[model samples]
Target: MNYKLIVVMLFLVMGALVEGKRLANLGHKLKQEAEKVGKEAGHILEGKVAQKAADVVFNAVLRKG
Candidate 1:
């Protein structure tokens, strides 16, 4: 009976370890995806800002002439 209990405990511990590792991997994947999305958004925003600045400069030059 004692041996059986020990075996059961060991299995439970092993299972918990496997589950923890799986969760860690999932968290890492989610973090990487979030970073990728952030970078893409930043690039799009930068382009829009640059275009707006160019337009403003162009209009100013035209008005002066």
Candidate 2:
């Protein structure tokens, strides 16, 4: 019934919606990246180099993305 409480509740709801969308997009991107990495990793390299590349790429993507 109070004006201040109504405004605060509306702000909280709007924030939750925005944050939920960003989180959803991030989750979707991670899934797609994981699959892409898995497929690409299976090709065209030896043991240590392949392993190192995968580690480096995965870490970089996870960090930057």
Candidate 3:
């Protein structure tokens, strides 16, 4: 009876550990996707700002440098 209880407990603990690992993996994947989206957004905003800056500087210069 004691041995049976021990075996059941081990299985329960293992199942819980596996579930935790799966949750962690899902969270990691979501974070990676979010970071990728953030990077793309940053690039788009940077491109717009760079273009505007170039236009401003070009207008300021009396002659092309």
Candidate 4:
């Protein structure tokens, strides 16, 4: 009886460890995807800001002339 109980406990612990590793891997993947999306968004916003600044400068030059 004691031997059976020990085996059962070992299986439970092993299962728990496997599940924990899976969750950690999932969390890491999600973080990488989020970083990728953020970088893409940053590039898009940077382009728009540059265009707006150029337009502002062009308009100012036209007014001065």
Best candidate per TM-score, number?
Answer: 1
Clashes of each: 0, 0, 0, 0
Tell me model 1's lDDT, rounded to 2 decimals: 0.99
List per-prediction Cα lDDT, in the order shown.
Answer: 0.99, 0.92, 0.97, 0.99
Residues 21-65 of candidate 1 have per-residue lDDT tens digits of 999999999999999999999999999999999999999999999
- For the record, the alpha-carbon RMSD of candidate 1 to the native fold, in angstroms, is 1.4
Clashing pairs in 3: none
Clashes of 2: 0
For model 3, how does the per-residue alpha-carbon lDDT over 1-65 read when each residue is reduced to its tens digit? 69999999999999999999999999999999999999999999999999999999988895765
Estimate, for each residue in 1-65, the C-alpha lDDT of model 2 and write its tens digit: 99999999999999999999999999999999999888777663566687999999999999999
Which sections of candidate 4 miss by over 4 Å?
none
Return the TM-score for each candidate structure: 0.88, 0.61, 0.68, 0.86
By the lDDT metric, which is better: model 3 or model 4? 4
TM-score for model 3? Answer: 0.68
- Report the alpha-carbon TM-score of model 2 versus the true structure: 0.61
Which runs in model 3 stand beyond 4 Å of their true positions? 58-65
